[model samples]
Target chain A: MEKEERKKKVKEEAKEKEGRLTGPRVIGRRDVLKGFATVPFLGAFAGAWARKRHIERELKNNLLEVVHLTAEPADIVPVAINSKPLRLGIIGFGLRGRHLLRATGHAEPQWIDDAKASAASNRLDTSYEDFMNQEDLNVVINGVCDVFNIHAEEAVEAGANIFRQGKGGKMGTVPKRYRTYKELIASPEIDAVIIATPDHWHAPMAIEAARAGKHVYLEKPMTWNVPETYELVKAVKENNIIFQLGHQGRQTESYIKAKEAIQKNILGKITLVEVCTNRNDPNGAWVYPIHPKAGPDNIDWAQFLGQAPFHEFSLERFFRWRCWWDYSTGLNGDLLTHEYDSINQIMSIGIPDSVVASGGIYFFKDGRTVPDVQQVVMEFTKHDLTLLYSASLASDRQRGKVIMGHDAHMEISDRLVINADPQSTAYSEKIKQGVIDPVVPIYSFTPGKKGIDGVASATEQYFASRGLLYTYRKGRRVDTTYLHMREWIHCIRAHIQPSCNIDQGFEEAISAHMATIALREGRRVYWDREKEIII
Target chain B: MTKNHHLREYSTFQALMLVLLRVSIGWHFLYEGLVKVFNPDWSSFGYLMDSKGIFADVFKYMATHKDILQAVDLLNIWGLVLIGAGMILGLFTRLSVSCGILLLSLYYLSHPPLAGLQYIFPQEGSYLIVNKTLIEIIALCLLLAFPNSHIAGIDRFFQKKNK
Candidate 1:
């Protein structure tokens, strides 16, 4: 009887312990004290450590996948290895060019090791010191000549074997480096030339580079018009020099991963994509800071005015080049191209069938010839999707990209946030009943047909549940300049075409340029894919 | 609430003026706050002086020393949002007006672009500071002079609810 009583007591105690373990336990003061008795700061420490580990794991996974994709060849089945660094030669020593050079891996050699030592010593000064010492590039040569519009003798004097056109080349003064581009291209040591010149000069310089047999890495909004882009594309194809257009975000790891996730249907069938860039500050809207030294004497006045309407050389146009229409494609070509390139890559969108736009020079009453705010809607046939792209020079909210699809919508910025909306009856039913039989396909209700905008509701719920509107920073968000330069180097070594090649660059430029035309003309422009023209 | 048996001459005129006043100021605050919220690179706390220059130093300091700055940034963002919401809704008008003035004042003081004591015409920096803060302060004064919230707002509804 006593033994039976003891066994009953033991079983009752076990039940109590299980309840405390599995169920939400209302701990008394004594129990709380007892919990913390063993390790005073254990809970706090563990929580922090767990969070760090989670973030680190995400970053590591991102790096691993990106490294794999970059190393592997699409043409071949699968060979995964990170790409080797390629050699790069920068021509200009100006601020913009210098920034690009600094970004292209020319910082400190032993910065990483120094960082560890600093961490051990708990010295922030050492950390700063390391950063200063560390270079971001393997090799960077200073003061290369702007071969564009200069005499061939001067180009040779500047030791520029790989000739590049600065803003001066926009006026059509072929640098005297060689009488024709043929001599420049035939140079043995010159492998590639990066044309970081104005819009009008882009096609001329790129064509020259292509003709020379030297690979070309040209800046954004590749050409002036659709016909120009087509011509440039032809030249690139004919020459087959490794051409990389300067939409550097395509080379970024975040963008590559985002693209992969979308291709893998991580966010389901994408239907709507929205991109916005708002700049409250003057500088953000491409109001270039006027250098005190800026004048006709300091700047190549006539050269800067090339192809532009017969406006005299002024400090304003020379310094604030982006604000002028003749010099640039305005905000659409300058800022919107980056957003568009990333959007197309992420959602696998080719050229859009039609583009509708609305814009005007509404703000910055400063003497500028381009619209400060613009919105464009491009409808793509393949995905049956429409992309909404908007930019405001007056406002500051810079929302990156939001892609909406059937199953889930993703708001992509520094990270890819896949949100599962509850209103998605398909998703909800799948969750509740679990995966249905392979033979039984689930039918989804469209927003209009359903009582509620099901997808919208699901998106709202998804955001609410997560206590966040979007997931941020899945991996380290890179400075795109470095990524672009790295790709250039990588292509140089591997003999592979960079992701944002001539064709992609030209297409991106045409897309934006057409939109600008549409907005300016106040008419819907139909892109004739057959003729490769914007009507 | 007492019903107005004696219809006064100034009441209608006063109502029109109050509505107009509230809306204009409310819009100004709303737009200002919204613009800052939208700008991606518009950081609340980043720059601190270094060899690079004032702007670079401020940004570098904020980026490098984020621990304290992050907390401050969160408050600033939410504070602006709340101010915007309050001003636009005309709910707690006086409180919103005072808060707006205080915010502008604090910002002005933090980076005072003031001249020496021979205060003649205010410089551009001073002019900018004074322009925003003065408007916010006037809005506060107006709210105080005539409790606009009580006239036609959530405050009136709340007053009734409490009663």
Candidate 2:
């Protein structure tokens, strides 16, 4: 019996050991401690992350207090589209004309089809989507005018595409095609005229439209020469018509912010401003491909010459009129005016006190009179600064617009970036205190980018520095041209002067003319502020 | 129960090293996820748009499609966060490591360090066929192969209860 009891006890002990090894065991302090060992690391991470964020927030707040600019883009007031549709007449239905028409909610069937195909093939190409989503401005093309027969017919078809559809889609009423701009401007059915003609014809078409009591949307440089500049301005003012010069840069969000920054004196004492244009393509150089069917038979060569010097009915002169001084205002009117107007919009630095310009057609030797490259320097003695305008059609090295000040320099494009100067008296104390870094932007404003990124990445900075043809308003990408046209239409209905009014156009025209004179004379030209003349 | 034999074979130093590696990776993922989650404007647009390699078109499509992009952004942010929490807490460690490997693999494929490829976002260090992302992925694989979470994690308690 004793032997049997010992064996049973041994077996029971063995069963207990097996139960300890395979079955659930009671929780011990050591087991609990080991299981929760890594929990402290998570607590440490949270603590460290919070502390780091606090320091960054403090620094960002300090920097923002010093800057005193809003992180969000300026608010855009939505225009009401309740009024009756304005009857429109478009002259010079060429490249720029087609673009302007599309901005005003009219695109040809071919363009619509092509844009759709492109979007389908490449998802990144949002052109078709953006165009289709564009708000429909209440306007109808009542009249169309172009020197070329094909362009006029195309404009008619595009005007009839009210549904914004592709080929074989629904169509609307076709606009009446006028053989001449004067005829289109005189039509009683048209309430407004959009002149997208070559340089020589801008003033004449605008003058006729203004006298006919029709609102005018004229493309830059405003006029081809000095005398016509005065004539166009006087006609528009005398007629009391809404005149909007096509400086779509006026609608850029960065320009608006830049204007505010200047008003706030964020850039201390202004010293110099530099703006540039760089293009490296045949089309950009005015070597536009000649239409095969374009010739004396289809084109109205006589009317096309309008105010331009008489030239043979050559397709080159007719198509690429910007290449010659006879029909074009050279680089000054064609390109420099864009740069000049953008500066004027930002600084309100009207006609410069004096100007000196020089350049030659160094790149393209395609029998063109206008220089393919040019540089113009305008002295703004009143503002205590010098405005430098440079152009290069041979190399597309982007040198963006910059406004320099004693304390800080601002680079403005679709975005604005302000960097404090190292030697700046205003920021030296902050720099020494390590509150500000000269290499980093003190104030960076990217239109669509939310909030302030005090230290934006290099890629962000690069993109911000690059020029964008489109601008953002309220975090939405909008065609600046569309905004400019909408502003003009709004002004016409409201009976108010548009953003780029006759006064602003006068400044733009006189400035461009002074540069052109300086280039042609190979001497410095002075602007007589009192006489309002370039001498 | 037999799996416990290999789990017990790891020396204290070896288990500590494995736990440290897992936590460090978790920290990286957690921080990355939190930063993006806090920033309202953050989007995978730039990264996907800059994608190179054979699957570039597919990634680019995801970036351009608004609904798909939103979904992708949510998935990426939450995936990193949950996977990171799982790794650090040693809860479902195997699953976390597997998910991390998959995420890193996608990143590696999108921006492979091939000889002729260049990226807009400047890289900190020069790389050839191998990069930091690839290294991290390999490390996650190592963790997958030798999981010691039950030894020094919340998994230890659950493991004991199950036994």
Fraction of native A-B contacts kept, per candidate: 0.00, 0.62
Candidate 1 residue A4 C-alpha distance from true site, Å: 56
lDDT of 1 at B83: 64
- Best of the candidates, DockQ: 2
Residue A162 lDDT in candidate 2: 92
> Residues A1-535, candidate 1, lDDT per residue (tens digit)?
9999999999999777555445553546654443233232234434654685576455435333322222211231111234422333334323354345445433222333444566555423333343233333333232233323332123333232122222222222222333333354455545666566667667776787787676777778788665677778888889887888888777544465556656766456677899987788878877767767545554556655655677876777766778878777887888779889998776658778889999878988888888898899999976789989898999877676777777666666543345454455436564454332212212111111111111123333333233222111111224566557656655656678888887678669778877888888998888898887888
lDDT of 2 by residue, A1-535 (tens): 9999999999999788667667767779987888888999899989998998898787787677668774233344456678789999999889999989998899999999999999899766767888898888889999999999999999998999999999998999999999988889999999999999889999888998999999999988899888988888889989999999999988887788788888888789998999999899999998888989887889999999987777789999889999999889988888888899889988999999999999998999989999988999999998998999999999999788999998999998778889989989988888899888988888888777666657665665653444221122123467888888988988887899988899999998999889989999999999998988788
lDDT of 2 at A362: 99
Model 1 residue B132 lDDT? 59
Interface root-mean-square deviation of model 1 in angstroms is 25.0
Model 1: share of native contacts present?
0.00
Q: Estimate each model's TM-score.
A: 0.54, 0.95
DockQ of each: 0.01, 0.55
